[model samples]
Target: MPKFLIQATYTAEGTQGLLEEGASGRRAAVEQVVSGLGGTVEAMYFAFGEYDIVLIVDLPDASAMAAAGLAVKASGALHTRATPLLTLDEADEAARRQVRFRAPGAQGPAGA
Candidate 1:
């Protein structure tokens, strides 16, 4: 399973609905949607700024994540950005991999 951080800003129509439904209702709805997709919402919060909602979710796979994103977006209630989270071990492994490259003043992948 992989985790993602979702930052969402509500549309004007969504905000109006939020004001009427309240925060708890929103949270419960999110939880239901995530759980229904074989995912879990680790945490969710409301924020004031560029984003109105922040959610940490763990999903089965990339396809599941994509489905969730599409469903949310199609609702027209929110605009969301989903960032995949990397674990410390994953970061270390990435750093250990060899990458072929050319730098300034270098000929090519291999010196010409």
Candidate 2:
């Protein structure tokens, strides 16, 4: 499973709903939504900054993440951003891959 870090900022109407429903209610709603998308909410937190909530979620793939993101954004209650997270082993593997590349103004291939 792939993991994602989601950051969300609630709108005034969203905050009003939260105040009425409470944190646990919100958590349950999130859990239900994620589960329906073939994912699980690993962790969630409320913060005081540019983003109001942060969540770590595990989903089967990028498409599932996209579906979840679109669903949330379509609600018009919150602004959400999702970033795919790579595990340490995945990062190491990516770093080991080799590729031929040239920066701007660099020399072309030997053939021209």
Candidate 3:
């Protein structure tokens, strides 16, 4: 399964609803949505910042994550950004890949 880190910010109306209903209800609702797509919520939390809520979820794949993002955005309650979470091994693998690039006056392969 692919993991995702979701940062969400609610609209003014959305916050009003949250104040009335509560975070647990919203968390349950998100869990239901994720479970329906063969995924599970790893962790969820409300924060005080530019983003109101943050969630870590494990889904079957990127497509499932996109579908969930579309659904949530369409609801018009919360705006969200989903970032794919990579494990340490995955990061190492990515680093090992032969990537070509140039920087400043150094016009050559990245490793050069």
TM-score of candidate 2 to 2 decimals: 0.91
Candidate 3: lDDT over CA atoms? 0.93
Candidate 1 per-residue lDDT, tens place, 1-112, comes to: 7999999999999999999999999999998888888999999999989999999999988788899899989999999999999899999998888888789897777432
TM-score of model 3 (CA atoms): 0.90
The better candidate by lDDT, 1 or 2, is 2
Where is model 3 poorest over a 10-residue stretch in terms of lDDT?
A: 103-112
Error of 2 at 109 (Å): 7.9
Candidate 3 lDDT by residue in tens digits, 1-112: 8899999999888889899989888988999999999999999999998899999999999999999999989988899999999999999999898866788898576863
Estimated TM-score per prediction? 0.89, 0.91, 0.90
Residue 64's C-alpha lDDT in candidate 2? 90
Per residue, candidate 2 scores C-alpha lDDT tens digits across 75-97 of: 98899999999999999998888
Q: Pick the candidate with the highest TM-score.
A: 2
Cα lDDT listed for each candidate: 0.91, 0.93, 0.93
State each model's C-alpha RMSD to the native.
2.7, 2.9, 1.7
**Overall local distance difference test of candidate 1:** 0.91
